[model samples]
Target: MFRRRASVVLLALLLAGPVIASPPAIDPAARNPPPTIALSHFDRFELQPVTLAPGLETHKGNVVARQYLDVDVGERVPRLIEPRNATPVQGEPRTLLIQPEVADIRFITGGKRVLFGGFAGSSWALVKLRLVDKATGEVVAEPQFLQHANSIAAGYSLGAADKLMLARLADMVASYLKTNFDAPVGSAVAAAAPPMD
Candidate 1:
């Protein structure tokens, strides 16, 4: 009887063993780079507002005829990848070129001056930028971002509007960068016994 009970106890212990073990956790955002590509975290930067040009006052009454703006999409990807055993990178000095198409303009803010009746014509411009993978000497991704039908407000221009635009656009570009640059994080471990949903 004693021997039989001991044997059953051992069997029960074996059957219950795996139920108590836990699976490993993984971060959803980590990506493992391909062998040829070295992945790195994104660098941070500050937004320095450009001082309104003196010519802007002269530009008003002329009307914002058109604007050509270029936002490169792929420039943001490297920041999403968290490279293993690598030091954080510093934000590079850079500029965002904004060429505007203006029409029906009455004023230009920032110069503390105004133009009442200058040349009134419509203008627009499109821009292209290249973002390179320095190590591979290749362009990883380049997406063109655009905003059409922009209404130029030369009179009492809201500085806040520009700030808001920058913040929103930067966020949009950043998300695109993260999606393209990083790989989906994988689970490093397997559950001893996966539970059925």
Candidate 2:
């Protein structure tokens, strides 16, 4: 009786070993390409292209400063068909919360322009921006940052200028991030592989 019980237990163990040792099962829902990252609207607001009087001009001023996104992925990362631009490795997806933003705007009046000798004031707004991880600047997979617009100097137009300027600044920053750095938005984190032993 003892020998029979041992044989049955040994058979069960052998059957279970391979199943547990195999790679984690990929989710059926993830066979399709992942959705584009669903970027959110700005959570807060503030003036950009700001400067101090004469101390710094538009070209030398900081264009923007604001905060957005503090994300935490609560579930398993379904297997993802990484974007064409994404780099692949056998590792887990990181806990990421991208603060996608445009920054560093300098708004100042040019020395002086001719407003019938009264001088047409020219407002010069130069922008520089980036995508910060808010979590760590040292991480390699961190989003790539680029600066698109520069010295959009316009004191000539008198209507909706601020909004338009802001819009341009925002768009350039977004476009920059999209073109460089990080994986495609909404890509999934991978699971840890089972031990080879």
Candidate 3:
């Protein structure tokens, strides 16, 4: 009977061990602090037209890519980052100038994507985003974002895949700004900045 009791207790202890050792659940907000405090200081935002890097001037899709980036990001910022608590700016409204420059792009044609899928290589774009304070002429943040459309399923949508990737990149930029700008000042650490891509 003692041996049986000992075995049962040991089994109970084994089952409870993991439960006792488990860490307490942490709040999601606490884990991810704001990425950039400088963004929070602005009352308004002005997005410059997206430009191509010097070498990309002759790229086939340069015009389309620039237009997409400009439109998508411009539309998304107002939807995502605006309507937040506004920090009062003295005299002129504190505006953040957002400049996105495409560093590189590899666009796979819809026909090729449909026929060859991943073998045609993924459609990707690398954009360097610079944020500047209009009032102080201070450069706030410069982050690089690389976005890709790589799903075999994306081939079904053909040309829409590249558009979707561009849209997602815009969403990411807007979301990042919203997350960082909405947080309380001093709450975010630079080391905890969200992944660029």
Which is the leading candidate under lDDT? 3
**Candidate 1 whole-model C-alpha lDDT, 0 to 1:** 0.28
Q: Supply the TM-score for candidate 1.
A: 0.31
Q: Give the TM-scores of the predictions, in the order they appear.
A: 0.31, 0.29, 0.64
lDDT, model 3, position 17: 20
Arrange candidates by lDDT, highest first: which order? 3, 2, 1
Cα deviation in Å at residue 28, candidate 3?
20
- What lDDT does each candidate get? 0.28, 0.28, 0.61
| Of candidates 3 and 1, the better by TM-score | 3
Measured by TM-score, how close is model 3 to the native structure? Answer: 0.64
Supply candidate 1's per-residue lDDT for 88: 50
Provide backbone clash counts, one per model. 23, 10, 0
lDDT of 1 by residue, 89-145 (tens): 356522222121221122212222122111111111211123344443454333332
lDDT of 1 at 191: 12
